[model samples]
Target: LLVLGVPPAFALGTNKFAASCASFTSSLTFIKYRVYDGDLLKYLVFGTLLGAILGVKTVLLLDSSQLRIIIIILMMFVAIYTLFVKNIGNENKFEGVNKKTIAIGFIVSIVLGFYDGFFGPGTGSFYIFLFLTLLNYDFKISAGNGKILNFVSNITSLIMFALHGKILYSIAIPMALAMILGARLGTKLAIKNGARLIRPILISVTLLYAVKMIFDITNH
Candidate 1:
């Protein structure tokens, strides 16, 4: 949409609108398969709700260039770390949410949700990483849980976008239909392929997005 001449705000709003619809369907799929971790969701959803609300408000006040740079740095760290850790997300070690995991979940979820609302890229990658490292989940479970959190944040932000009249309904509706089909298929594949499929895709997408952000920052 950006390349197709949509304004940045409207592109983001429309993308969020479409993604929110897709993520809702994806979340339901994950839940039906029982692939997601329910123990951590309560905390993650709560933190994401608050953080997304705060983030949308903050984006109105602050220049996001600085935040982009910071996110780039964090993305690089996550990518590099995941690349070296071969067995990181291969197995599920999450026994159940405890005090320590709960604290970590709230902290990471709030920060990532804020990033999602403010900048709107690589949010799923961040969530997957946290679920793997902090919450002890496998790639399939991580992706499943990540979608749920992503949906919460996306919907929260989408509401803000709609209220501001930034979304293009015609474009968003068609794209949303496509996204639903794509997201459902992707979720099924992720469940079937597990870590082998998810790890490389996650790494590749994060690196590509980082590079794109770098180019965008330099050009701007």
Candidate 2:
């Protein structure tokens, strides 16, 4: 949308709207598959919602250029690290809910939720990475849980945008329809293929976003 000349605020609102639709659909699919960590969702969603509210409130007040650069660097590091760690996300090592795991979930979700509400790029990917790293989930389950949390954050941000009258309903509605279908198909594929499919895609997405950020910064 930005490349197409839409204003940043409008693009952010529209993106949140469409993403809310997609992530909601994906979350339902993941639930149907029983792939998500139900025990931890409460912690994740609560922190995410709280952080999203704070982030939305502060979005316009912050200078995010430095943050974007840090995010790009982090994304690049994640991509490279994942590329070298062949078995990292291929096996699930989660040992059920524990105090330490719960704390990590809440903290990471809050931070990424803030990032999602503030700038909104690569939040899902970051969630997936944290799930894999901290929760010991395989790629497929990580993606499932990540999408669920991302849905919560997206809806929270969408509500804020809607309240502020930033959303373009005409564009967002049609885009949401397409997003729902695309999310359904993509999620089905991920479920079917598991880590073999998801790992490379995660790495690719992280690298692509990093490069896109670099491009945006250089262009600006």
* lDDT of the candidates, in the order given: 0.87, 0.89
lDDT (tens digit, per residue) of candidate 1 on 21-98: 999999999999998988778777989988887877776566555777877887888889889999999998886888
lDDT of 2 by residue, 88-126 (tens): 988899978889999999999899888888888889889
Model 1, global lDDT = 0.87
The lowest-lDDT stretch of 10 consecutive residues in candidate 2 is 57-66
Error of 2 at 160 (Å): 0.8
Model 1 poorest 10 in a row by lDDT: 56-65
State the displacement of the C-alpha of residue 190, model 2, in Å, after optimal TM-score superposition: 0.7
Scored by TM-score, the top model is: 2
Error of 2 at 114 (Å): 0.5
TM-score of each: 0.93, 0.95
Give the distance in Å from residue 130's predicted Cα in candidate 2 to where it truly belongs.
0.6
- Best candidate (score: lDDT): 2
